[model samples]
Target: MTATKVAFTDVKWTMLVTLHMRAMDSRQAEPVLGDRFAAEAERRIDYDFGSWRMRVTEGDRHLVTLRAKRLDTWAAEFLAAHPDAVVAHLGCGLDSRWLRLAPPPTVSWFDVDLPEVVALRRELYGDAEGYRMIASSVTDPGWVEHLPTGRPLLVIAEGLLMYLTAPHVAGLLSRLTTRAPAGQVLFDAIAPWVVPTSAMLSPLLGAFRMRWALSDVREVERWGLRHRDTETLLGHHERVPSTLVRSVYGVFARVPPVRDALRAFRFDF
Candidate 1:
């Protein structure tokens, strides 16, 4: 008997972008977020990572891992405050974030993604005691109803929002803040300049179609969230441990205007 291979199609194929990055990080001499599971899992699947060069370039190959590292840091801090937190990792791909984070046994972790992606996840990793594999689109209103109420909830959307409409992201924030007593949301987004045109045509963006771009994450503060924190992610000075990538991106960061071109933002309510 042989194991079934992962077959994510259409928009679901976008998940591979992150998958490729993790696999590459594992191969790095100094992996920023060296996800071991990603390396092992990538081997099991027949996905041709070598051919994905059009998308994950030499520099971007490093940036994707950095984004994951920062998001993981934020998630860890949130869990520290609410050990029994309810986490919804929207657009959860093949990356082993839940297992790596290893939240306290009391925490309830939900890995949410499209039905196809969810099926693949269950097939590969199955489910843990407090872990749930949710098969549904993140934009679906019904998904929110399934979450436990009156608990500290942390919603993580990595490499997800830019693929969705602006209204959808806003609606999601509104839902989470209103549904959970204490809540936090962490996500990454493209800068505005890259949004309207340049990024959509960039070879690096590849299969990803940028629908929303926020050069300044503070602009999203107008979405009506009472509290928010935004940080420069791709900029050289911020958390980018790779000296090579820092030197490359640091040039743009020095421009000041490109400070938050690509960023990770956290909103608390």
Candidate 2:
């Protein structure tokens, strides 16, 4: 495998933390990951050498687990509906969603991310029978042309939107929608207020960097995506306790009603 050209930074570290969180959930769901992945994930947590130290925030961890479960459910349903569907996970990082979903042999899954991230993933997980990895920035429309455009595509952007600016995200969405005639995209978003503040304070959260270039859900609709659903992820998921949600989001919760103006939003498009 080629050495990763991507430098370790807070933004990239955040993805690693999220991936570890999901791997932990997989261990909890089914011992499929067994001791190996779990132990490796634990070691990553222990070393704490990354840009952002992986702190298991109760609410954030809870939300990560809940979202993993929900994504698995959605992937299973999508596979069942379109047995031959093509699923693309944008900015996949080191996530093993394919392993978690275990979609049938007929399902074709593509894990797409930056070249460096993809290189690191290949070293860590390698490719499977029906799974492939594309090393390219999501903003590049060229990658979409390589996918099986004939089949319906289920595109997933988990915890990726907030990092990109609105125009770049909008362009990516437009390209995907146009490239794949009919498809659904599931992604998470935060209110406009959270974007600027998070961007400013991101450096403090370890090397876990964040940049919020987008604000409105309506802007996504402008790119030809229809809003399908919005749900509070952590506590509302039932999997996570309300207390945990309050604890994790409590900082945000403490924000005066004026600050409440900065609530996050999840959209299915």
lDDT by residue for model 2 over 154-186, one digit each (tens)?
A: 888877877787677878877777766576787
Error of 1 at 37 (Å): 1.2
Off by over 4 Å in 2: 1-7, 23-52, 56-59, 206-216, 235-237, 241-269
* Per-residue lDDT of model 1, residues 7-119, tens digit only: 55545666776777787778877678888888777677766666654344444766678788889999999999999899999989887999879999899899988788887
C-alpha TM-score for every candidate: 0.89, 0.77
Global Cα lDDT for candidate 1? 0.77
lDDT of 2: 0.64
Error of 1 at 236 (Å): 5.1
